[model samples]
Target chain A: MFDFPEFFSFPLGDWINITVDWLTLEWAPFFDVITIAIREPLVSLEHFLWWLPWWAVIVILAAVAWRFAGRRIALFTVCGMLFIGVMGLWDETMTTLAIIVTSVAVSVLVGIPLGILAAKSDRVEAVARPFLDGMQTMPSFVYLIPAVFFFGLGKVPAVVATFIYAVPPCIRLTNLGIRQVSSEVVEAGKAFGSTGLQLLFKIQLPLARPTIMAGVNQTIMMALAMVVIASMIGASGLGLEVLRGIQRLDVGQGFLAGISIVIVAILIDRVSQALGRTRETGLRRGG
Target chain B: MRKVLLALLVGIISISIVLSGCGEAEPEEKPLIKIAELNWGSARFQCEMAKIIIEEGYGYPVELVPGITIPMLQGLRTGDVDVYVEGWLQNQQEAVDTAMEAGDIVMLGFINNDNWQCGFVVPTYVIEGDTERGIEPMVPNLTSVFDLDQPECKELFANPENPSKGLILNGPPGWECEIVTLEQVTTYGLDDHYDVMNTGSSEGLFASLQGAYDKGEPWLGYLWGPTWIAGALDLTLLEEPAYDEEVWNEDHGCAWPSVDLFIAAHKDFPDKAPDVAEMFEKWKLDTPTLNEALAYMLAIEGEPVDVAIWFLKEREEIWTQFVPADVAEKVKAAIAEM
Candidate 1:
């Protein structure tokens, strides 16, 4: 058998620990600001969703579904909402929705810029490719540890964890969408004396709309998937219900919560896909 | 060519059939005892140890299934699992009550009494300054949970998020301690000065403490004994009012009651495997003995199964007393060979 000396140990874990400790100490104020920024909107959104009458929310969602996805999906959306309410998971479902919304919102705000950078620069793309792959491939639960360490426990950390887990798809798709824009169209825009910003907004962005929408759709789904795991770090709602169910072995409660999550996922997915398709057709027709 | 191919195929089938027959000729009734392994160290080690003994000693095949408290209890009910070596009954009163009412599970015996203790704890450095580590005494006058009432003492544990109020780290969501600690905070009127931060898991709680301890920062959190973190860390259990059953139940202001860690089995367990059930009745461990094993696990950073084997090899006198002479010899022989 071969042997290795103790002196060869790199102590990577110690170095990570020291770095985390230093970061936490040095950037406490910045973290606090992030916590408040995320927490306030999440709290307001939860309250707004819960405060509205059930019928009102149902009607609103159905109308949106109808406008985007047409009659069949609209019907499905109404039924799903009713089922969620009947199963007595309405508030929990809303809490989960609020979390997904907040996480996706933050992920988009941060992710889109990175996607643009990666699309424009070969060097940036080279660096970002592996990082995005790591983010996508890493188990969502692993995010919760450092999340708790940095944000403390509760919805803030949960949102942070969910954002990290959900952001990769949006970034990847956005970059891909931008790169996939027809080179001829870009050249034509440049030949017409369009500014760089004008080209990006008027030509490339509109062309990439469908793919970016797909990215948004993917980001939303990933965020929802992460909701349950985020409950481990104190994000309340359907995830907590599921966690409670597992803890007490309450099969009924767990199944109902899980079904509610699926229903919510379907509603969001249909509406977003519909919106994307509608815009895609309009672009084709106009062209 | 066709005739030769048919003959080859027939010969291969015949050989496989003979081999399969030989494989099936072994004992047709070897019972598999399914034991539940919990996430925590103590439960994992205890169940693994039992699994090794039952397999080697009684010649009963065993399977270890990993699960948390609730699902494992459910497994016991539905017969998915045959035994759970460490059942913290008090924390799981509701589920235990329901199962007992249905007559689906039975408490075998206490594994250890006074072995499991849960309460508020502070790093020992808070009280006794560590000169070698260059850590100052942050809460020198802190003697009891009551000392937290003092503004200065409360300030010592102030969290960055809520600097106005000190934070007391509670157990994870859905744990029995979370509810009890929440009640205690309200009852003690400490909620005004202290915010109860419920950690995600025992791992989360321990990490918070470990991070604080490494930085020589003051921390206050709910913790228990016979755990690797407790056994390894230098922490001081804060004093509390003596347990008064009536007051404690209604208000939960007093300290946590000592937990009787025990083994529990499915109702049909005895009928299905009488010998194993009987062996479970005799299985018992003292606090120091269990703590020592947990400490060894911590020191070597060993997995539960490996630690169980190590324990079996080292603690022959303790385990041998539980089983008959022949079975004991068998287990010892198995360990020796390993």
Candidate 2:
């Protein structure tokens, strides 16, 4: 038998434990602030979504679908949402939707600006590229540990984990979108004596609209994907339903909730995609 | 994007096909018994022990399939797994009852009698002042689970997020203990004084306990016996009313019942392989023996399979009691050579 000497052994686990302990003690107030900030909006969104009548929600979704995608998808959205309601999962679906919306909103708010910074500065790009790659490639399950340690347990940790897991694609795409704005267009903006902020808002952003929308689309999908994993840390929704199903070994229940997730994913994916296309078309026609 | 989507779809379909294809017909000469491998140490070790014995002594190929309790029970019902080594009876009573009623599962035998215990626990220091460490007892008079109803006691374990109500750290959501703890809170009329905070997993629950223990903070949570945590930590199991069969079954508050880990098999198992079924029925490990093995694994940080192998080699006398003389000889010889 062979073993590493005491001196040769690294104490990475101990170091992490110490660091986490210290942070929990020293920054308890900061963590409390974060929890309140995230939880208040999340609860309100969940309540609002739950408060709306199922038919009203379906009609609103259908109308939005029709406005962006067309009548066929609108009808599909209505049928799909109605199916979820028929499954007795409408409330859980709404909760999951609220989570996805909040996470994606946060991801976009944080990601787009970081992406813009990365796009502007080569040094920032160099720094952010690997970080984004790491965030994207790291197993989403690994996010739950630090999340639980930091936020105790509940929707806040779930949102934080989802944000970390989902923000990368938004940032990557935003950076790519802005970078892909043609240099000639940028030169034209400069020739017109446009300020940097004016160049971004009036020209670059409009030209990069489709790609940025794609980023939002990816971020939304990624956020939706985190719903089930987040449930493991006490984020309530259809994910918890699925988790309950799995815990009790009820295949019928598990599959029903799982299919509900897929349906929700498809509805959100299609709507976002259609919205992106609608914007692209609007920009193309207006320009 | 179309090409990428098409490629992904094709890859998924082909992989699924290949996976489905891999479950080809077994050779008639040697049958395979699929054993369920659970996440915990004792369960995994017992699974491997069954696997090794069934393979070597009985001349059957054994496959250990890793799974959690619920999915494994489902597998047992669906004939995907032939045997599950340790089934905690009360915790999984609902699932087991439905499966048994449906005639898909059979209880083989008790693996151990009155070996499992679960209840609210707190750091010993909560009750006993640690003079060496210069720490006073947080709740010196706290002994019974009912004592948790006191506002002073609740204040000792006040939840950081919800200071209005003390938090009773329950097991993960969906665990039987989570529901049980919540019911206990309600039944005891402690709902106003305490909130059942469900941790994400056993690990999370223990981490919270350990974190508080490290800081000499008062903490209370649900925990079970024959676990590494209980073995390693100096803690006290809060007392409750003595077990009552009628009261225990019908939503009454009482101490956690002493659980007997049982072996479960597919309903068709005994008819298909009577000898293996007989061996399974006779299989038993007393609490101390099982605890020793679990403690060994925890001490060495050894894998379950390795622990199983060690158990076979070290404790041949105990397992040999379950099998016939010839089979026992064969198993002993196999272990001797290993």
Candidate 3:
């Protein structure tokens, strides 16, 4: 009998690795392009040329909350900002906030319209639902891989990954909100000879405002969760602090950063909830 | 005249704002080289050293990306990461094999070639206890793997993941220990003597090792060298079957030889940022220096940056190897002035 030992004598591992290289050659450039586009801007913002001041941004945030939400939400926002400041993580928190805000803004611009379209057509919703489910359920780490593959790493890839994470909630919420519009309101608009655009602007979206806001709220929270994980791919901010803590086993820094994130999350949620309440009151007055 | 002046001022302000929004000339951009740094003791120190040079020494904004071994390799192959500094070639042969085959990564150079391997180890007390049935004093002709078949050695492996039999502590599943240990046991005909218990985190492995060391209990499992575990505890390796390259390769082989760590970079790094690549190539750390840095991070300072600074300060001579002679003197002068 021939000895089987000879079969395993070769550097099987090295040979196998060479084969994998042959396969990935085709798609590497696309990953490189995406990485370059996303990472460069974020890197500049993080390192050399941060545009916004922490206190100024906080003031603006509080002002927006007061205008849209109410006194309670505005107060909560101030407290949240103060907590992070007191913890000495104000800069880190602001950096994270900038990434989240930019990503959410971009995601909304892309997701809301797709959500509206999906709600309007049965076939579209059918096509979108599974994709949304996969997006939601797929492990967050896996999102980073495809992101890094497509974009590379840095601020842009980080944001793209964050967008992937934050988009699902907004899309689902937008679709849900639009679909939940009262049939009577839609009918009244149609009777008034409202066109599709007018109906969307006047009836469906207006009625869906609370649900859409809820979606936005969820998106914000999801984006916050992705912040630290994104740091694994070079998206710096509060998450980098948390990542450093874990890497160096610094419990104090990790927990403090984590607590700051919790405060920010609560602050955002309450402010959004208050805004939703204001919208509800406005709807009541209009009705 | 007042109204006209006011309108002109408003126009200028609006134009500036639009200009700032529209053509705020994009700041000079550079290709970001993503380097994945593992959380393991040596790996993290290597990362800190590389990051210090890349960020401060070379002034290239490097992102010391965080990840575990398997994912880091995945990142490498997929172009998610440009380089990984502390890839242990022998232990991570499988992952490296996959990555290399894909042509996603290139091996730059070795970082350090220190003595490191994995195998079963038992405390001194265990060897002394009931020498025939227990681990000690070569009782019952316990010279080879066949001696483990004795009934008294039943509790040899008892780790949680595989609690039913003799225990073997598993590090990360992808580690070479998994395959090598399995082969060692099989070749020595000790397959029925012990069971391999898989554990995911280094913390888990250490915690178990510490517990056994403290109690002086007979513990046998996979471990590597130049680590805090070896530094902290004293243990002896169990006998292994003789090494035959052919039989070994077929059987998954013995404890892996120590691998040289590397400081790698993307190809564009040299073209776009030659200075950065020059600094990287010149970067090297001996085993003792890395061990000392790790000890400081884990034992003394307990901060990555503090450890990095300490190493940089303490090893001024080592760093001079990388800098130009004049620049090296300047660096020393700067360090002294600071």
Best by DockQ: 1
For candidate 3, write residues B1-338 as lDDT tens digits: 99999999999999999988876444555567677887777777667766665654454567878887766667677777777777777766666766666665666667677656346666555655544334344333444445666766655544222344666555533355655676777766667657654433354456546544543355666777656666555566666644456666676445455566665554444566676566667677777777677667766635566676677678878876776666555445545543
Instruction: Please tell me which predicted candidate would have the highest TM-score against the true structure.
Output: 1
Worst 10 residues of 2 chain B by lDDT: B23-32
Over B1-338, each residue of candidate 2 has an lDDT whose tens digit, in order, gives 99999999999999999998778654555667889998777898898888888888988888999988888898999999999888888888888999999999999999886665678899999899788777798888898888988878988887654577888888876678788888987877888888776566666676566656655668788888777677667899998888888877787588877787989999998987789999989998987787788888878877777788899999988898899999988888887776
Q: Tell me which of candidates 1 and 3 scores higher on DockQ.
A: 1
| Candidate 2 runs further than 4 Å off | A1-37, A40-94, A122-127, A259-267, A274-287, B1-29, B55-59, B94-104, B125-136, B152-163, B172-175, B197-219, B267-276, B313-317, B324-338
As a whole number from 0 to 100, the lDDT of residue B78 in candidate 2 is: 97
Local error of candidate 3 at B80, Å?
3.3
**Candidate 1, which CAPRI tier?**
acceptable
> Tens digit of lDDT per residue, candidate 1, span A1-287?
27887788897976887888886767767877898899889888998999999999999999999999999989999999999999999998888888999999999999988888889998999999999889888887666666666666677888998888899988988899999999999999999999999999999888998999899999999999987888877667898788777665677888889999999999999999888889999999999
Proportion of true contacts reproduced by candidate 3: 0.00
Q: Residue B268 error for model 2, in Å?
A: 5.0
lDDT on C-alpha atoms for all candidate structures? 0.86, 0.83, 0.67
True contacts kept of 2: 0.25
lDDT of 3 at B17: 96
